[model samples]
Target: MDDPIYDIELEDCPICRGAGLIQDEQGWSVSVACMDCGAETAHAEYRTPEERLEAARRVALLWNMGKVVHTGMSD
Candidate 1:
């Protein structure tokens, strides 16, 4: 299956400059997380396919804007 979230461009981790990943929980919500420092954006919940895409986009935007929560490392 091709998830549209994968099509969205994401910025590197604000804390570690590592790769970012789009993660979903049980197909209901999405968030962007850093692969190295574990920084993440707030979860965007969705109820439909359109919402899912929008949620993905929202998180990606937040990530690119450097609005992320770093829980693994000190800033």
Candidate 2:
């Protein structure tokens, strides 16, 4: 049987805290990719509304720049 997707915790962007973007005191910022988590997305993929919203927020903040993490289920 396939394991639960959000078991324990979802593979979300750590840097952006699932928001997907980060800013510095110097008025500079950048977006990150959930690419680090390939297992979750590669195998049993699931997209909850809250998750999508979080992903969207991160992408939005990037304005289509940088990698917006593609996190997935993993250890």
In terms of TM-score, which candidate is strongest? 1
- Find the 10 residues in a row with the least total lDDT in model 2: 37-46
Output the TM-score of candidate 2. Answer: 0.24
lDDT tens digits by residue: candidate 1, 1-75: 877789999888877889999999898999999988889999999999999999999999999999999888666
Evaluated at residue 25, the lDDT of candidate 2 is 17
**Model 1 residue 65 CA deviation in Å:** 0.3
Over 2-62, each residue of candidate 2 has an lDDT whose tens digit, in order, gives 3221122233454333432222112222223343443112111115645534543454444
Would you list the clashing residue pairs of candidate 1?
none
**Could you tell me every candidate's TM-score relative to the true structure?**
0.92, 0.24
Error of 1 at 20 (Å): 0.4
